[model samples]
Target: MIRFIITRLLNGVVLLFAVATIAFFLLYWGAGDIARQILGASASQETVDLKAEQLGLNEPVFSRYGEWLSNAIHGDLGASWFTNQPVTEAITSRMGVTLSIVIGTVILTAIVATILGVSAARYGGWRDRTLQVVSILGLAIPGFLIAIFLVRIFAIELGWLNATGYIDFTDSFTGWLKSVTLPIIALSIGAMAAVAQQVRGAVKDAMRQDWVRTLRSRGISENRVVYKHVLRNASGPALAILALQFVGLLGGAVIVEKVFAIPGIGQISVTATTQGDLPIVMGIVVFTAALVVVINLSIDLLLGFVNPKVRLS
Candidate 1:
């Protein structure tokens, strides 16, 4: 287990390094005279040059990348080029809100997907076919459109929830719940559809295995055999899908944040990208890459712990 974990961590580190390298160079080469853009066209040549120097744009691109990467290794992500706010600080401030939504979506998806999947597998009738149809539709529709529908129905028409804006949990727990509920649901629908299908397939496959019959023959109760042995075997794959869903949610959260008016990492990401705020943008890129690595590592570790073959390998 220890060896497995260590190997996974090393792999994650390599992946993070690769992502940071690509993100850094792409932002650097593609951005095109950020200082000039910041200073505007009317600014004189000398002033533009000074602005470039101040922003470190005049430095060799490779040298700047080296400095940035080195500082990042030492836990110094630098400051926002526009606001001059520390990159880490800026991200952390809104990180919680984004995480809260994503986490809620995960939990909701897990519970609902499990129920639907297990049921569809067990019943295997009209319910199974019906679920397949709905799941396909759920997967096909974009998350933002669903969010908009939710906003129109729940927030505007019914006035049951807030259409836009965020509330801090510290300020009011109820308000915060109301604020995040729609976003979480919007994200969860697609995930639920996808995961439920995986779970259903896994469960059905497990039920068909000879081990299930062997257990039943040995006098194990039906429910116990199905829930304990069958579900356990089914869990491994569903868990992997869940991790992938987490990554998807992060991407989707950007649009969800804008539609819902939540000041999360996603919101800041949009603003930073629009303004060519490279420090903030780079910081976010690194943060996202790190987030993905950590989540994937955790899942791999979980799988290793759950399955002896994986750990032994």
Candidate 2:
């Protein structure tokens, strides 16, 4: 297991390097004259040129990439051009908000999906049909639309919660949770639906396996046969899908954050892009890429533990 973990960690490092390289070149290539964008339209040509030179934009892409990569390795993600704050500091400051929402939604999704999926699979008929309809509705609705509707009903009409902005958890845990509740629900809807479908499918497949048939034939209770035998076997695939979804939830939270006005990495990224803050944008991209790599590696390691055959392979 240690050997496998080390191997995966090394692979994650390589993957992150590749991602950083691609992000560097792509941002430089796509964002032409980043200095001008940063300096603004009214700035003189000479001033813009000087600013570009200051930012090292005049250097070859490969050279700049090497410098950025080297600094990043040392935990220096550079300073934001607009805020003049360390990129890491800025991201870390807002990490709590994003982490809270992501963790809450993921937990909620897992519980809701598991219960609904198992129930539907066990009682396959009207209950299954009802769950299918609900899942379909979840998939069809857009998160932003849900956020809007939630804001209207809960924040505007009923006045139960604050509709805009974020409150610090340390300041008021209740307020923080209340404020983010709608956004979390909105973000979780699609994930819950997808996970439910995956779990239902996996459970159904597991129930048809020969082991399940034998267990049933041996006069094992139906609940034990389904939950203990079938669901346990079915959990591997469901867990894999859930892990992937957890990573995806990070990306999806960005849009939900924007709709609900939560100050997080996603909101910061969006703001930096609109303001043409190249440093912050690159920092965000690198950070997000690193997160994805880490999540993937963790999932791979988890799979090994969940299925020893995978470890042997």
Candidate 3:
């Protein structure tokens, strides 16, 4: 298990390095002149040149990449060229909103998927078919489309919630919950579909195991046996799917954040990319990659703990 964990960590490091390298060069070559963008097209040639020199844009590409990589390794992501705020500080300030939505979406997905999946497995018939149909529709619809539809129904037509806004949890937990509810539901739909399908398969398979038969033969209560024993083992695959869904959520948040007008890393990423704010864009990318790695690692550790067979492998 220790060796497996070490190998995964090393692989994550390598993946992060590759992601950073590719993103750095892509931003550098494709983003045009960062200094010029910051200074505007009307800025004099001399001024642009001075700004470029100050930002080390005049240096060799490799040398600049090395410096940036080193700084990132040391937790100094540098300042945004446009905002003049440290990239870390900017991301940190907006992280609360992003995290709130992500966490809420995950929790909602888990609860909905587990209930729907287990119920479908336990009661096969119209219930199972109906759940399958809903899952397909959920998967078929794009998250942004869901966001728009939800905003229309819940906020525009129903007027139950704000169309687009965010509130800090510190100010009012109730306000924060109300503000984030739509976005969370929007983000959760696709994930819930994917997770429910996987859980249904896992639960059905688990129920067929010999141990499950043994428990049933002993006259154990179906609910206790299913929930306490079957679901615990069945959860391995579900947890793995959840991790992948989380990565998707991060990417999906880019569109969802814009639709909901939430100030988050995703919104910042779009703005920084458009304006060629290299530091901020790079910071968001690296941060996202690192998060992906950490989540996957945690899932691996969890799998190993829950299923001893995985530790042997």
Candidate 4:
């Protein structure tokens, strides 16, 4: 298990390094005259030259990469060129909002999907048909549209939640819940539908196994046989599917944040990219990569716990 963990960590570190390297090169080479962009087209060549020189844009790309990478290793992701704010500070400040929505979505999706899926599989008539129709519609609709509908109905019509903006959980836990609830629901609908189908299929397969009959023959309660034995056996696949949904939720949250006016990592990322704030953008890239790595490792650990055979790989 230790060896498996070490391997995953190393892979994650390597992936981060690769992502950072690629982003740095692409941003520099592809983005034309970033210093000029910051100063605007009206700025004189001499001023641009001076600004570039100040930013070490005068240096070779490889040389700049070396220095940046070295500083990054030492936890010095340079300050934003425009605002002089540290990149890490900028990302960390907004990270919580994004995380709150994403985490809530994950939890909601998993629990509800599990119940719907198990019921659909075990009872199979209207429940199965309903699951199929809902999953299809959920997948067919875009998340942002769903978010818009939620805001319109719940926030505006029902007056249940604020239409826009975020509240810190520290200020009021209830306020925070209200702020994130619609966004979480919007992001989770599709994920829950997808995961529910996966769980349904897996559970159905598990039920077909001969051991299910053996368990019932041994006088085990049907609920225990299904919940304890069948669900546990089927869970490996369902967990894997759930883990994959994190990536989708992270991405979907970005669009949802914009619609809901929530301050989050996605907002900063879009801002930095448009403004050519390389330091903050690069910081986001590395930080986001690291987050993805951590989530993947956690899922791997969970998978190993659920199905010990995973660790053997």
lDDT of 2 by residue, 1-313 (tens): 6776788788878887887788778887666787788878999999999988998889888898889888988999999877789989998888778988988898899899988899898789998998899999998998889888999999999999889899988899889988888888888898899899888988988887888889889999999987776776777777778888877888888888998889998899888888878778888777777777777777677666755656744
**TM-score for each model:** 0.96, 0.93, 0.94, 0.96
**Candidate 2 lDDT (Cα, 0 to 1):** 0.84
What is the per-residue lDDT of model 4 for residues 79-132, given as tens digits with 9 covering 90 to 100? 998889998898899999899999999999999999999999999999999999
CA error at residue 134 for candidate 3, angstroms: 0.6
Alpha carbon lDDT of residue 107, candidate 1? Answer: 96
Writing each residue's lDDT as its tens digit, candidate 3 over 71-95 gives: 9889999999987899999998887
Give the Å shift of residue 311 in candidate 3. 4.9
**The 10-residue segment with the lowest total lDDT in model 3:** 304-313
How many backbone clashes are present in model 1? 0
Expressed as tens digits, the lDDT of each residue in 1-313 for candidate 1 is: 5786798789889988999999899999777888888878999999989988987888888999999999999999999878889999999999999999999999999999998999899888987998899899999999999999999999999988889999999999999989999999999999999999999999999999998999999999988987888887888889999999999999999999999999999999999999899999889888888899899888877776765556655
- Evaluated at residue 101, the lDDT of candidate 1 is 96
Per-residue lDDT, model 4, residue 307, is: 63
For candidate 4, the per-residue lDDT at 215 reads 97
TM-score of candidate 1 on Cα atoms, chains taken together: 0.96
Better of 1 and 2 by lDDT: 1
* Colliding pairs, model 1: none
Per-candidate RMSD vs. true structure?
1.5, 1.9, 1.8, 1.5
Q: Give, for candidate 1, the lowest lDDT window spanning 10 residues.
A: 304-313
